[model samples]
Target: MPDMRVVLARELGYCSGIRRAIDAAETALRSEGTVAATDTLLHNAGEMNRLGSIGLRSVELLSDEELGAATVLLPAHGSTLSEHLGRIASARAVWDLTCPIVNRAHDAVSRFADAGVPIVVVGDKEHRETRYLMEAAGSQLLRVVTSEQDLDTLEISVSRVGVVYQTTQSREFRQLVLAWFRRRGIEVAEEMTLCPEVLRRQDGAVALARRCTAMLVLGDSSSANTRRLVAVAVSACPRTYLIGDAAVLPEVGLNCVDIVGVVSGTSCPQTTIDEVVAGLRQVCPDVRVEVDAWPESVL
Candidate 1:
């Protein structure tokens, strides 16, 4: 086996929004003994399981009885159901944990819709954030563009369109959508809604991946930001793997690589990143590990 070195990205793990949500969940769990969310609070499974063990519950939709009796926590990703705002008003208690950034995106879309501008949302149509944006735009929402194919099939009757992004989308994708609008001589009122912490992690992952022989992206498979990190890393280093936990490290053939890079999604826990580092050390006993220093402010 080759001598190995592991480099950990500086901006790995939980963003402020996710931290705020998790903290709120724990607080609610302690005070009320049970708290419910309309959906999984965040994209990470491990964190959800940890919270679940302590009385955090997720429901597809809260019933009137559940709403009347339980403390309901709005998800960090925000919600599409505007009617829920009315229902939540009558709940026992409500915690609106929507990220400030997401709220800003919502405000931007609402302003565009109020101004009678046709809106184009550039993100996964099925994503909760995208759905929220669409709901904010209402009938002014033209369509959602997830790929170049979506843009190719797009038929815009208007000369000017307002653009909004899912908070976790990549800058590259944003640029692609903007460039498409530019080429067509369409005026764009672009709202910069991408989460800064997510972009920082992506930047860190790509930088490390460019120099390493293999890259490991740590986060739940269902996490959109985590999947984006994997995609960006794979573009820089072909031997990139997305693992939910440390147990998958041995199967990833890190022993063959001289240099390995590790990065995690914003929703990932710090403990998971530590476990991955420990797992790397176990795989290559003489491995040298280096971790970058994180910034003081991420917002």
Candidate 2:
């Protein structure tokens, strides 16, 4: 008889902001006949597909044709609110679903740009959230970096640097970047704009990894927070795998590990977590699963 134990992270699955965005999108789609988003409204493909089946359209960028034909839903990840709204200009019904925390991040970066301070963003340069932050900063002196190596390539001439990161970046990574800039004698304004829930998820991932023999992170490939969860888990538990769903569990050699921790990205659906746990049960029928509640203390 194989002895298998699975533990669920306390802070796994969808955060309030994502829930609100989805709820709002669903409500709007029902009333508006057709709704379009500036980008994928949520990173979870399952949730996106659900909305798609009901006629929720995703547009890479809004053009006159899109603005005129349907209600445009701005994503929870920050978008150029004023700019986008202005472009529409009373031509269409618009729902501003930008998360309040993300809006705050945008405002913080705008303030730094207004003060003429050189800006450095710690996140994936091509990420939608990072792109929003860059757009909010306008033409200010800006550099975006993910690691210490990326920082070395910056050609910044300013002595004073303003720092802000994507809402999904882990706090530990943010501190490391801040320390690196300070060591170089740069005056770094540390305006950490990370989502509290997302940061908590990373904390939870670290704790989950420390206790489990292996870890499974649930999230879509395009989810930033999901990728962060994977990174955090791998740092502590070398046997960490990022899977979009539970179907990959078998191929990833899960049966070899006696204990596994299950953590998910903020945007990941609760149903996916349930499905993964169910799949685990099916794989190891006699396995005992426990809910790891260590993350509750941090909350």
Candidate 3:
């Protein structure tokens, strides 16, 4: 087998918002007797398991039975005011961990709706963040499109529109939608709503993919950012694979390739990244791993 080289994406692992959410969850677990999260607080099952050991529980919805906890924590993805108003009204102590970027998205959607501009939300329809954005639109003329193809189904006969996307969506997808609208002679308000850190990670994935024969992204399947990373990597390298953690490394057959790229989403913990790197070293002992320098602040 040829000597192997592993190129690490520059922007991998947790971003500032995810770091804050994790810290807040850990803090809640320490002080509260029981804490229930609106959703799996940030998508990393290992981290959730660790928090669960300390009395953190995640509920799909905030019904009466789920609201008996001492504290209810909101996921960093944020939720719609209309959809979550009842829960917010009933919670005894609520720790809203919604990221500021997502809050801005809600504001942007509200503003566009208020202006009577047709709003298009570009993201996965099932994603929590996208669902919240849709709910925020209220009775406004709104459409949700995961790709450019979805736009064709929209009966938008208007000349002007506004665009907002799930915080973790790629800029490439957003631009594709914008370009499509512009081609049809429609004026786009263009609220460039994607998260900067998420875009940075996607760019990092593309850069690494260009030089590697294979790429492995570490993150949970449920995470929007994780799915974006896989999509970005697959565009540049067909051998890209998305794994939840280091344990899946050998099974993914990284040993069969000579050059590999490694990346993770903002929801991924640094410990997971370390384990993935170690797993790569162990499985391919002769390989040279060149990890890019990342800021220590996120760790």
Candidate 4:
């Protein structure tokens, strides 16, 4: 018998933020009877497809056709909240699925701006969460990249910089950016509010990958956390695959690997993980499967 060992990452799966967002969307879909949103509730294609089969659909932004009726769900990735306020004013109902973790970040910046601190949101400019935070904070926001190029070009002299981050970005990235601003001797009141769910899941992915030669990172392609997990696995182990489901598995191999690991993002469901694991086991019956400790530490 080929000695096969499968390392199952304990932390590989949906984060609490995605769970809460999906639950809120489902509940809103049931209660409101019809719903639409600015974009997909989560980055996962599988979950969006599942939602499509039910009733949660997205509409073109602020069109007259989608106006006057129906509930709209703002994705957990917070966008400019004020942009929503006016549009939602016309809707019969609004189901705010903004993750509490994100909402806490929003509050931090909003309160800081209200207190007259000049705010600098450190993250990708195009991300939905950054956009939302800017809108919520109104006039007190400017986006900052890793270097000072963007900040140097700015015409304003900010007395105090209030920093906020995207909930799903790497915690290491968040810390680096925060430290960069403070190093300049500028007054900074920074809120380190990146979602714990992200760091927890990321650490879990790293831990799980340690025991396996190969890993399958289960998650949507666009999911920040899922991508991070796949990256972590590749770094820890030699070979890693990022797949939405078992169908995404490469046809050429899997039975060849003596040790394989499976992990997923916070947005992924248990069924998807089980299905992939089952398929891998079917291909290699002798493979030993064990839980990776990352998720256990998180819980």
On lDDT, the candidate that comes out on top is 1
lDDT of 4: 0.73
* Candidate 4 backbone overlaps, count: 7
True-structure lDDT of candidate 3: 0.80
lDDT comparing candidate 1 with the true structure: 0.85
What lDDT tens digits, residue by residue, belong to model 1 across residues 1-299? 56688888877778999999999888889885447887789999899899889888764465677767889888898876764756666778778889999999999999999999999988888888888888999999999998889988988879999999888998788888989889999999988988887888877787788888898999999899999999888999999999899998878876745788888888899899889888888888788888855443344
Tens-digit lDDT string for candidate 4 (1-299): 58567777656566777788888778877874558876878888888888888877665654655655778877888756464666666776767778889899889988987997777776656768777777766787765453346555654355567787766767666666656667666677878877776777677677767776677888888876678777766889777888788875656267645577777788888789888877776777675677764434442
Query: Which candidate comes out best when scored by TM-score?
Result: 1
lDDT at position 132, candidate 3: 79
**1-299: candidate 3 lDDT, tens digit per residue:** 65578878777778988889989988888884667887777888888888888888765444675575458888888765753676555666888888899989989998988887788888889888888788777777468898766876766877888888888888788778878887899888878788888888887788778878888888888787898889888989999998888888778776635688898988888888889878887887677778755432220
TM-score of candidate 1 to 2 decimals: 0.93
lDDT score of residue 236 within candidate 3: 93
- Model 1: lowest-lDDT 10 consecutive positions: 290-299
Count of backbone clashes, every candidate in sequence: 0, 0, 0, 7
User: TM-score for each prediction?
Assistant: 0.93, 0.91, 0.90, 0.84
